[model samples]
Target: MKRIVPLLFLLVAAASLPAEKTAWAFRTGINLTPGLVYNRVWDPGYNGSALTVMSLRQNGGFILGGGIEAGYNYTGFNLHFPLRAGLTVAGGDSLTLSANLDLMPGLILGIPASYFLFALEASMEAVWQVSPCLGISLSAGPRYTVSPGYGEAVSPLEFIDLTVGLAAVMGN
Candidate 1:
């Protein structure tokens, strides 16, 4: 009962947010990166993070959404839930360029232990509208992950992730 009440309230509130286009788009992508991941010690490794963003368009230049990403950071697996906002920079019939930011509060689970993770990512993309229902994008971003300690173990604050990836956007 305790869990259900807050969940219901959240659903109602999300449904009430204002949208201009009245149509929603879902963005899905993948990030392939060679960087550093640390738990007890830092190592050079490759981390691939899958991403999705569902955007609700507002009347002006902005759109809002939220989505989750679950992936492997070489040493461990993690889940990232990110809130997204996009701004249309230049738009036309075929091509559009936009800037976006994702604020993520994430959870890491696997190898060494589990800890809390947070990352702020900013990216820019050029989206080519293949059809009214489909588009493809290429994007890159730098993510700074906050590593707060769990239990008595103190985690370092030096998890910087750089990623470049391709995305597919599908909608009406």
Candidate 2:
């Protein structure tokens, strides 16, 4: 399932590409995403009920500030790559300062479906955005906890999180 997800995403991305080549546009928008996040823990030598712990329910919350996006229009769709960083508030007792670096390769289908857009993105986020001057963005995609060191002492932390939030672009 893990391997297949990426393959499917690529297929969708390729199919969405437009036939006509056009100049890229820098776009900025505000979005709100409300979804579920999954949490997991991995221990190298631990076993017997302590080997792995997981939380796969809707217990996580996220908020995006403002973001900027850049992309080109091909055929009739727009292919975009956006970067967003925000705060993550979990339902659990723990509170984490979270940020994500995501490659949101998506298409904004022309009219009729104009107001709607879709994309598949992969992100690598840290505890916070490096620069405060940079704007925040809103995006949705599969989120994975590649490095699990947040709640190390109490649990081995790892998660496949789904997040929805908004971003504000600064420079643009």
* Winning model by TM-score: 1
Q: Roughly what TM-score does model 2 have, to 2 decimal places?
A: 0.25
Error of 1 at 167 (Å): 1.5
- Model 1 spans with C-alpha error above 4 angstroms: 1-16, 36-45, 51-58, 110-113, 150-157
Local accuracy of candidate 2 as per-residue lDDT tens digits, 1-172: 3443464455334323343332111224433222233334332221111011111111134322212233322223233333333334322222123444443433343443332233333433222232433334444455333222223323433334344434433331
lDDT of model number 2: 0.32
lDDT of each: 0.67, 0.32
Q: Write the per-residue lDDT of candidate 1 for residues 1-172, one digit (tens) a residue.
A: 3443454344334533765556566778876665556443667666566655544343456756666677776436776777767788988988988888877776676446567767888888788999999989887777777656542365354566676768888876
